[model samples]
Target chain A: MRKNGVNMIKISAKNVDVFYGKKQALFNINLDIEENQVTALIGPSGCGKSTFLRCLNRMNDVIDICKVQGEIVINDFNINDKGCDVVRLREKIGMVFQKPNPFPKTLYENISYGPTIHGMAQSKQEMDEIVETSLKKAALWEEVKDRLHEPGTGLSGGQQQRLCIARAISVQPEVILMDEPCSALDPIATAQIEELIDELKKEHTIIIVTHSMAQAARVSQRTGFFHLGELIEHGSTDKIFKNPDNIKTQDYITGRFG
Target chain B: MSEAPHTVKSYEEELKNLNSNIIKMGGFCEEALGKAVQAITMRNSDHAESVIKDDEKIDKFETLIEQQVVNLIALRQPMAIDLRETVTALKISSDLERIGDLAKNISKRTLLLNENLPKNLVDALVRVSSDVQKQLKSILDAYLDRSSSVAMNVWESDEKTDDLTNLCMQEVIKYLKENEKNLDDGTHLLFVTKNIERIGDHTTNVAEQVYYLVTGKYLEGDRPKGTEPIVTGEK
Candidate 1:
């Protein structure tokens, strides 16, 4: 909802461009993200949706050939700045990937790892509280509370994904990025994650990249459709799926063309 | 544009099947409307009975078309224009089905007047019949050719059928005034005229659907209503 008909901006990107050495991946793209809203990025394979998502948190910096140029403001910070502390920057923004990758430790340790590394908990009791709260927020507390000492890797595919989400929330990040976080899970698990996403948006800004249009339609307030490395259209999820302004967006969503 | 010919041919075939089924149903509706009118004009009770019975075929089309669309949505997960197209087909089929009901209603009135159709009522029924029949045909043309102009033409001209119906009702009343013994025929003719007018209304609705299917935008405004002209001084 808009106050006084003006949306509050949580993340803003301007003229964002990405290149793999000489081969350009993303064209100049501008997107305005509203506070406490789930923004979904959707496109065909290799349309650079994931690449553009990585630019938000500077995940592309790890790739030797990938280079991103843009102004991305997370609240008041120019995260692309050279002097910006990469370690602290990552703490403020947490990410869940296409597959669930949990730490090779107990479920309790998986949720406590981030807070412990960041010095968020001063005592063992504080650490335990963080673990429990994060797991509850991820909606995995009841399912795995009995198995807190069990290895995170020993959980079901859905349970493991929720563990990763809890781990992301453990540090109390301001924003969460999910890169097709439910792609490897079953329908029941995908539905659980979608439900968890709706709940998390109350406290954290969420941006998700998913090939499932239905998933994007389910979770996002604002949706951006990318094609051929360009932002084809960006609008409310209803308009994007019901009556998109761009023909390319319509074609891709309608399964008419890639 | 041309949808660039979908990657999956079977999806295309499924969509084609839906369109063909709708067109076939439209043909059935048109035939019923025309036969109902012919039955009254020619004083043929058999033709009137056939028109009433044929409505079952249209109801079947409604069931079949609705099921196909539901399955297509579930199995194919159509989106954007394909989504709009499937929904529009459902809407049109529904209108056509209702129009079939109106045609059946008209034939029932025809059965009541099979032995006593007033000369003026026959002429008026013929007039309303041709007017609404032409509108239905032209709207179908718009649907098949994806022509909004034709659809708009049908939309704009709906008032003429309403005017003809009003005039037919007036004639029926005048016939009753001349012969008090023919009160039953006048009452049935009054109903028949209204039925024909409603047929025009449903045809107009189909025209609006055509406009949406072609342009992907609803005709933005209140529809042109065919108001019933007030009748007075009845004994």
Candidate 2:
């Protein structure tokens, strides 16, 4: 892990590559995901945006056939290092997925689960405070406050996605990786989630992988355009949309092709 | 994508060429006005003839600069200040060319007045011609230098030319009223006065362009009393 309070990158990828067993899924990737700003990774489907995102906190480690090469330095530690603590690393970097995967437990316990696993709470009072604060940060506290004991599965899909966000926030991660976090939500819920992302950027560095160009244009300060597992161009969002230097980037933004 | 550097350099070159061509055309028109007025006052038919010939060159330069401006707009896709400068150049060139045309008109009047005339009336026209020539030169200088102070001077002096033209018109009317035998001479004198008045108008047009070139804004109608000074910058 990075030394406390020192100048360390939030996340840095150098010459990174990913493979699902034999077939390579990503080319040599180099990027710096900065602190407290949104960096959007945009590309067509199956272009390795999600695969690259999963490498940050070792989410790809679950797939036995997948192998990742190169360093992903978060703080001072590479999560791919042999002796690195995967659980502690994951606790510092949380993720919300494409679909809201809320647990079958009570809404209160869903948030408390991470802190309990990490031994962060000393007693019931501390655990209850963590749950309430996380829900508040996720902007779901008012609706769920009266039914803290209700099952998380009973909430609507939008609320469940927010519950997953609340669960992720409960761990107090330094960085948040969102892989199409609002893909299943309606327009209103998507807007709420986008606003939530905007607010979260003030505290945590965010890296989002999205397929929607307009969404990337709306939410990101910097946009990286990927094509066929390669980063074709990357620059300020305004330039990428209005006067892109690369033809591929211009084509993608202008709807000539993906 | 890879040609960005080349495109930028080429656009810069085109802009430079456009500016230089405008300055060159302005110089040619200024020269034509000087010779045209000199021919009228000195009664030198050769100088008057040369001024008429120079008008053709001025027209050619105006046409060339206008084509360049149009091509720059269509090809370079200029925006912001570049757009403003290109449009301003287009307007300025046309105004300069019209000033050339007025100079040609004065040359034509000079040729007509060089015919047999009363010496005193000829002397009066000579004085008026010199004064109008000075105003034209100062106005052109103000435009070239983008000097609003000089432009203001040109604006103030326009009234003097108007007063002289009115006096000349009155003199011509008196000649017509008193001597019914000299009706044709009086009519030509009236034409000479009208030509001088038109030259004054062209001088004012140049002053207006000076104001616009310096401030990138139009000045029209009555002058604003105690208005805030316009801040000058490249548009």
Candidate 3:
């Protein structure tokens, strides 16, 4: 169904399967990530939530033995097509990991790294403008405006995460993938990152892989419960948390088992 | 012992049983309140004695439903609206149990005020008890139907019961100040009125639970706005 003038199928996957050489990691999965909204993928430790998340941007392709099947269409373009520009596709899709892996450089240089490498910036002044805008978009400009030359590693854990987000936005990506981005931070820092995620949804479609159901409940608009290498249930956050349709989804949400 | 195929009942059947049990318990409590009021108004200690005898049945019903609620939660693991319904049943059953106690208190008062009060004071007490009885019935109806509008109406009716109880208390205290002849009877009358008012309050608690069961939102400290204005002196 269409909502708020946007197509319902922002990203569509049909009968998608992934294999790591001899072992199948995902089986006949199907899901859709809507536009300008956060969709949380939650399951047990090895239920392929992170693996499926990686498939969205073809991040799993780097693993030598991994092979993906079926079509993953984003904005009417099939990403699995051979002629698809993987580099340009990645430029429009960004990723953040479990740990806040900021580059070992100044905050300004870190945020500007993507645009500079992509040749998106014409001059040093343009790169500076891009850095400032990206930092502002990530809600970190004021905290590090005077410390632009300071090393990103000098900042605290939460600050480093926000800096990483600033770097993601620096490239002007359409979608941002967060793989347990707040798992390393304290509650207060997690709350800050969650609030930033909520704000960032106004401009970017986000897909988060979270081990914490409470975090998923707090930050996500939609949630997909994964189980045993399959997408079990995907629905509105309220339904998923309150009255999931699937028994396994209910059991997992209520802590019956992993 | 054989496993016996683990004869499991459907959740719908369990929910139906819970609803019927609540209604049955509510009916018994309603009858107890009615008879207790009659015993006070007619000076018939036998009716009060019967109500006191019926308290045991209400207690048993409360325990039965309480166990069922626990079983429902343990077995069904209900979510969302169903979860709210189970939690509300647990709370409402406890409130009903307390209302049963309040009925017992009224019967005790009836035993105390056997033949001492004058006619006018008894009339005022009868009016207060009757108002409480009507409000309690409406609250029970609201809960069973899961009607927010009816629940809101019952909540408003509780204020009327409160007003009647206050007036009854004021009349009793006035009579005490003037004569002091039936002070003990007046005090018992006050206790009975307070008990009935408390029953009204508990019924409103049940009504609030029904509201939450329907809406999935707590009605804590919230009065529904722009409801029909409560008509006074028109019970």
TM-score of each: 0.93, 0.55, 0.65
Clashes within 3 Å, all models in order: 0, 2, 0
Q: Given candidate 1, what's the lDDT at residue B103?
A: 86
By TM-score: ranked, best first = 1, 3, 2
Tens-digit per-residue lDDT, B1-235, candidate 2: 1112223567767766877777787787777777876775566899888988889988997899899899997986553234445776787788778878877877776787636566666666766766777887787677556687898887777777766666566666666777787787677667767777677766777677666655545676763222222122111
Predictions in order: lDDT: 0.88, 0.77, 0.83
* Runs in model 1 lying further than 4 Å from the true structure: B44-46, B114-119, B226-228, B233-235
Model 2, stretches more than 4 Å misplaced? A1-8, B1-235
Residue A133 CA displacement from its true place in model 2, Å: 0.3
lDDT of 1 by residue, A1-258 (tens): 468977689889989999999999999989988888999999999999999888888999999999888888887888888988888988988999998999899999888889988999999999999999999999998988888999999999999999999999999998899999999999999999999999999999999999999899889999999988999999999878877888888878877784
- What DockQ do you compute for every candidate structure? 0.57, 0.04, 0.13
Weakest ten-residue segment in model 3 chain A by summed lDDT: A249-258
> What is candidate 1's lDDT per residue for B1-235, written digit by digit as tens?
2457667889878888898888899999989998998888888888889989999999999999999899988998877767777888899999999999988988888787747566767898789889999999999878888898999999989878877887787788888788888788888888888888888988999999888777777888876656568485252
Ranking by lDDT: 1, 3, 2
Q: List the residue pairs that clash in candidate 2.
A: A2-A76, B81-B235
**How accurate locally is residue A14 in candidate 2, as Cα lDDT from 0 to 100?**
84
| Tens-digit lDDT string for candidate 2 (A1-258) | 235753335788888999998989889988877677788988878888889989998999999999999999887777899998999988989999999998899999899999999999999999999999999999999999999999999998889999999999899999988999878999889888889999898888888988777678788877788888777887767667655667666555544452
Task: Show pairs that collide, candidate 1.
Answer: none
Best by lDDT: 1
